[model samples]
Target: MNNAGRDTRQSTRFMLLYALAAAGGATAYVPFLTVLLPVRVADLAGAQDIAWLAYVAFFGAIASSLSNIGFGWLSDITGNRRGWIACGMVLSCALLLCVTQVQDLTGLIAVIVVWQLCLNMMLAPLTAWAGDCVPDRQKGLLGGLLSFSPALGALAGVVVTHPGMASDDVRLMLVAAMVVGCVSPVLIMGAPRRFPELNQPSAIDQTPRKARDWAALTPAIRMWIARLLMQISEAALFAYLYFWFRSISPGFGDNDVARVFGLVLLVSVPFSLLCGRWVDRHNRPNLPLVVGAALSAVGLLTMAAAQDLVLAIAGYVLFGIASAIFLALHSAQTLRVLPRPEHRGRDLGIFNLTNTVPSLIMPGLTLAMVPLFGFSGLFVLLTALAVVAGLLLVALPRPK
Candidate 1:
């Protein structure tokens, strides 16, 4: 094969590998955060695990948010994302084992805080690394591929938390092993130097720009806020979907809910990929987001109005697929608006705040809204948020 063909093949392979590693990164947290942490907190804190979980969550979010930006910038200076990722993978995986040693909520909190810090060390650079290698045209497909991460994360949670795992230590060990297994392939077999700058030599940029103030970079900021809004809705549903379902029907089991949740995730992967390819084919790049946001609004509306289990599930499926499309494609498209190649890590870190920030927002929002108007009211508010998020992109000035 010619050089050009080789580069194409390598690029394809790199995207696939990156997607796998990204999914692995999600596994680093989703399973533990969703399943094990809660169980551990309950075991330690007993009746107060809810409060303890909130404390761990609040502190953990702060730790992750700070570390993501900090390490992303560090990677920018070092030009060694892979090295940082490898180091992070090792350290964070070690921290997973530490979770097994914690005998109290306070100790668990400490381990979680530190683990979050180590986890984002891998996550931050791993996120920015894509823009450093892949060009804008292919970012859509990359985003489509990235949709796989959450699915795998959820699957990992299911696997390790299965009834067969009788002990917390065993579960934690399996999680660490899974994290290592999922993430190591990329570190071992590095992205081909087809895009040499993806492997830029160690160098420092002492100047970190005030990226927020730049007029030219305004679109990226808009995209960031838009994403944060949509994510808030996602976070809310994620935390409360079970209770919301129960409110509809007392007989709805966790397995039924899980199947519905899992099916939506499975369906969204292909839907997002199709939408990503559509955007790539046409120059109407923001069209999918606008359309996705509209559909998300409709989905949320459907759920709010749903009177039966069947209707509620249908509405949730719609919302799930639409929101997934918006988020997945929006992520890849954010790369287009980032003005600084050298600062890709830093800027992407800023963009990623949307992910962590929602956790901080959701608890307060849920408390204030759910009690007043119930889940239906909350869904209506989310519908409005999604609409506004879509509009932010719609009103954005087009690139000349």
Candidate 2:
């Protein structure tokens, strides 16, 4: 292979391994948040399950939001990504084991808070590490590779929730073990050191730019807003999906919903990968992001209008595919917008607010909307948000 071909192969290998690490890290605790935590809350709280779940989610979100930024900043200062990632993986794994011992809502909440902290300590640095190493041209391909993260997250849920698992403690241990297994490769091999220039922002021009000079910053800001809007829609729908499905179709149980969700994620994997490849090959990354948002709007509208399970499932499939593409692609594109490579970790941490802030807002949004206009109202609101999300991207100036 020529040097270019060799470099491409190396990038592909790194991205795939990185994606696997991301998937494993995600699988470790995401299932717990989406599935097991609720069950545990119900088990511990009885009639107060709903309220306790809210509390846990509220605290967990706060922990996640703060830790993501804090740890990312810490990584920036230390100029080390792998060490933080490795330490975080180990810490989170140990904490996951500690969770198995928590017998009450308070104890569980405490453990989850600590788990969120450790998880982000790993995740934020990992995200910044990508920006440090991956060239801009390969970002779309990287995003496509990242499509596996969600699939792995959903699959983790399915595996841990299996009837054969039988014991909650055993399931928790398995989740931690899987985290270790998945993250081991990246930790052991480590990422290439970031270019020294990427860690020295002071050497670059620090003067405020005129309007003409603002071109580079505009897309990044728009992308941030775009992601925030889309995530709000996703968070609302995801948190309430089970209840919404139950209300629409009484026969559908937790397992049924899980299966549907997992299938949707699985189906989306190829489409997302294809979209990423297309974006990279065509050099039209922004267009697919816009399309993904528009598709999400259509899906939300379909669900809002539908009164039956079939229609709802169809809507979910569309929305799932769109969300998968949008998130994966957006992630890759984000690396393009950072103004200062030296502050990549901190900047990415700030960008992650789009991910975490929505969690804080969605619960309240759901509470307010569901009572006033029901799921239909919520979907309609989400549809509008998706539309706006797409439109915001239109304002992004084309790459020079």
| Per-model RMSD to reference | 3.8, 2.3
TM-score of each predicted structure versus truth: 0.88, 0.93
In model 2, which runs have C-alpha deviations exceeding 4 angstroms? 8-10, 190-216
Per-residue alpha-carbon lDDT of candidate 2 for residues 1-400, written as tens digits (9 for 90 to 100): 5975655433555677788998886787667776777777778889777667767877888998899999999999998889899999989888887876888888888988998999999999988888777766678788888888887887887877876764888888888888888888887875553345444564445656565347557778899999999999877666667678988998876667767777877787888889988887888888989999999999999999889999999998999889888998899888887877777888898899898888788878877888799899899999999999999997776554
lDDT of each: 0.81, 0.82
Model 2 residue 201 distance off true place after TM-score fit, in angstroms = 3.5
Best by TM-score: 2
The residue pairs in collision within model 1 are none
lDDT of 1 by residue, 1-400 (tens): 6987656433777788888899899888866776667667767887665556667877888898889989999999998899889889999999999987878778888998899899999999998888777766677788789888877776777777656544788887887888899889988886554566444433434555564347557888889999999999887777567567878997875445555766787788998888878776775678889998999999999999998999999999999889988888888888888877788788788887898888788877777887799889989999999999999999876543
TM-score of 2: 0.93
The alpha-carbon root-mean-square deviation between model 1 and the true structure, to one decimal in Å, is 3.8
Error of 2 at 333 (Å): 0.3
